[model samples]
Target: MYFVKKSIVIVIGSILISLGINLFLVPYKVLDGGIIGIGLILNYLWGLKAGLTIIVLSIPIFIIAWVSYRDYFYNSLHGMIISSLFIDFLKTNDSLFLINPVYSSILGGVLVGSGIGLMLRFRTSTGGTDLIAQFLCDKTGINVGILIFFIDSFVILLGGILLSTDTLFLSVITIMFVALTTSLFTRNVVQA
Candidate 1:
């Protein structure tokens, strides 16, 4: 039933997002946004595990959701845990295929965005900053997509300062792709 469908979607979405990170973004030092970006920054700067970093960074947000947004907490908890674990586990795998950094960024964005959109469609997501964005969206009536893009851009800018101009440029392209794809994929879904 609905639970089974949601589970399957979450699993598939998590795998796709993990593949995008492990096979494309990580190799090139490109970043997505939100907790994932933070995780990547930690990995780049300290050799920390990106997934573990995501989990750690997400703790405060999850705690907030648990207290004030129980439905969101219930919906997103498994998605967050599964996706984070998959991302960490899949990091050991070799890249699926070699390609230019630009192409990798685009493909990574698409994969990650599609995964996120799919989960959102099912009323679930990988949590983290996404939950914050959702809460803001509910209160402000702004498009969640736009909020996510702005948040992502801020992260990428911070990353640019810490990483490289190339990282920033490529990440901008990646986030744009993610925004477009997520919007398209979630057109009929409830707003996140």
Candidate 2:
């Protein structure tokens, strides 16, 4: 029963995340944090598929998780695969609605953050840096939320340097919302 519930949550979360990226962030070229951010960068710079890029970039992290954090690997593998596929599939769809870039950033952040938080609450995640964050949190006794925020900020900074200042600012706003919403939802849930 627990397994079934978790699976359902993960699928729903993945769908929400895919919708956020495709309908809001991708249209504005706004980036999310972690592997998604890297994927977005690849998409903007080289016209690569963001979902494919996410899977490719996450390989090393997943490898690390498999070796050192077997439980996390098991928990997150499905989430990663499902979410990546959904992201790629949804990217091809037309935008659900058009809005200002700022509004898009906020809305995208909310959707992505809520999806991520819900999965995290269920002891699952989209993997990638999230796995690393969980591992580090376990080892260092740091709050996962804070660690995630730091990692996200670093990625956003890199995006700023590699992309544009406008992207930086907008992405910062998006990530702030992501971090806040994620923290709110994951507050009472189990830590990875």
Candidate 3:
């Protein structure tokens, strides 16, 4: 039963994240944070597939997780791979969610936040820098959410410089929504 529930969470979470990225974020050249943000930067810069970049970028993080947090390694590998694949698979569907960039940022943030939040609830996540944040949280006893926000902010700053000023500003909105929505989903739930 536990396995089944986690599998379901991964699938739904991956889909929501993919839709949010390909449909909402991609169209506006906006970005999420962490590895996904990096992936978007690559995509915007070179037409690279975001999912592939995420998978490739996540390798080192997963290796670290394997060395220290065995459970996180085993659990998040599937989430990372599936979400990355879903991001690429859904790339062809980009025009599906066209809207005002601000609206896109809010809705995209909510979708991604919900996906990530659900996975985190199940003790699985899309890994990448999220895994790094988790590792930092464990070692430093910092709040995982705060760490994630910081990582995300750095990514947004880099993206704004690489992409455009508008990307930086809109991405701030997206991250705020993502963080808020993630908080809502994980509210009262014990962190794993």
For each candidate, give its TM-score against the true structure. 0.95, 0.95, 0.95
- Please list all clashing residue pairs in model 1, or write none if there are none: none
Per lDDT, the best of the predicted structures is 3
**Backbone clash numbers for all candidates listed:** 0, 0, 0
With candidate 1 superimposed using the best TM-score fit, by how many Å does residue 170's alpha carbon deviate from the native? Answer: 0.7
Model 3, position 15: C-alpha lDDT score: 99
Model 2 regions more than 4 Å off: none
- Please give the distance, in angstroms, between residue 38's alpha carbon in candidate 1 and its true position after superposition: 0.2
Prediction 3 global C-alpha lDDT: 0.89
The CA root-mean-square deviation of candidate 2, after full C-alpha superposition on the true structure, stands at 1.4
lDDT (Cα atoms) of all candidates against the true structure: 0.87, 0.87, 0.89
lDDT of 1 by residue, 76-165 (tens): 989999999999988864676679999999999999988888887888889987777777877887766677788999999999999999
Q: Tens digits of per-residue lDDT for model 3 on 32-77? A: 9999999999999999999999999999998888898898999899
